[model samples]
Target: MHVRHWENSGGNIWDKYTVKMFPQEYRDIDKIYEQALLVSNYADNAIALAEKLEKAILSLEEQPYRGAERKYGFYAFKGYRQLTVENYIIIYEVFENEKVVAVVTVKYGKSEF
Candidate 1:
């Protein structure tokens, strides 16, 4: 079966900051925002780091044996997968039925969780 992809329009507090200030910090943030919008225009578009984290998570989920190391609590969700992105980690579970990927949370560093 072909892998399906879906985008969500959810944003956290930190993500809000990224959205507000990234335009001032770096011009690349605009590009990042555009790329993310490709998934969902209304979705919470994050900075470069967040985009990187999402790409990594997607890669790992498609092939759970790639660079991602299986961690505990992964089984809590049917297709749970986690990955690190610039000191921050993103946890998400893949759902094959709806062709969607749901992000559970994005937190700073592994210790934050």
Candidate 2:
């Protein structure tokens, strides 16, 4: 397969897929950070964790299908997928037409939307 986005030392990644985060996803990440702060009273650790979470999501640029289909069938879009990072689930969808993997939302793994 040919790659077109996200580069590493080995080679380029993505099947021309560009990863992007939706506004709701940003808010979800902020909520997680805020919750962490409430528990530990520190922003450093929370920030680091959030960064790592972001990296995990970016890693999906080339493997947009790495996540499984929405099992509950509650999602509006049929192409919805879920990627788990620690206790959080990153909801994303691959748009073949736009060559984009748009992160729809992020939520605690065990929680329901």
Candidate 3:
């Protein structure tokens, strides 16, 4: 989805990136919501957490490179970037040629896997 536009400091318009989520991204978030619901036993709190994660993921359209590069674990040096929201970490990559920000996956921050 094309979430927003981009403008530089000098008011120069830059190409906005299209944010695309992989199927795994959706499943990862759903898992988060389910786990949250299991723990808090509150649907509203779980929904709020999921919404916050979605908002963070959508914000990438404005600045795809804002996230920190993955420097550890399996994703290290793989051109992946990570955005942390609450207890979840979002992994994505930016394809400048395509002007697309592809959300690769989401994982619980505290999980070993």
Candidate 4:
């Protein structure tokens, strides 16, 4: 999906929001997907889950404000917002000036921040 953003560093309108997934998010996704594969003994399910998650994270591109303001969070999550997919929460921060969106972490609903 295409997401409109302010002019990029080179002042190009064609540029999309820079999506950066942090190391923690990577580890979280990997752990969850691997568990799914182990439980179901089906790689397809894990693959599908990963693809679905990627799509959810990308939704921040068009409207970063779409996420609700974070309350009662740690210092680093100060300006971050969350997007939920099923039981998973995608934590991210939007750098409007640079037109970048950083996906900080993906955690389960029951987990404490």
Every model's TM-score: 0.39, 0.79, 0.85, 0.75
Regions more than 4 Å wrong, model 1:
1-51, 54-70, 73-78
Better of 1 and 3 by TM-score: 3
Pick by lDDT: which candidate is best? 3
* Residue 61 accuracy (lDDT) in model 1: 33
Runs of candidate 2 with Cα error greater than 4 angstroms are 1-6, 13-16
Please state the error at residue 2 of candidate 3 in Å: 12
Ranking by TM-score: 3, 2, 4, 1
Misplaced by over 4 Å in model 4 are 1-15, 73-77
Q: Compose the digit string of candidate 2's lDDT tens values, residues 1-113.
A: 12225665554543547888767777889999999788888889788879978887878776778888887736645779988888888888888888788888898877867
Candidate 1 local lDDT, 1-113, one digit each (tens): 22334333564322221111112223333444555568556556445545676466555434433334335554343455665666555555544444344455554454534
Tens digit of lDDT per residue, candidate 3, span 1-113?
Answer: 32444443552245567788767778889999999999999999999999999888777877789999988777778999999999888989999998889888899887663
**Positional deviation of residue 2's Cα in model 2 after best superposition, in angstroms:** 25
The 10-residue segment of model 4 with minimum total lDDT is 1-10
Q: Estimate every model's Cα lDDT from 0 to 1.
A: 0.46, 0.78, 0.83, 0.74
Each candidate: RMSD: 14.1, 4.6, 3.7, 5.7
Candidate 4: Cα lDDT at 81: 84
**Reference-based lDDT, residue 55, model 4:** 78
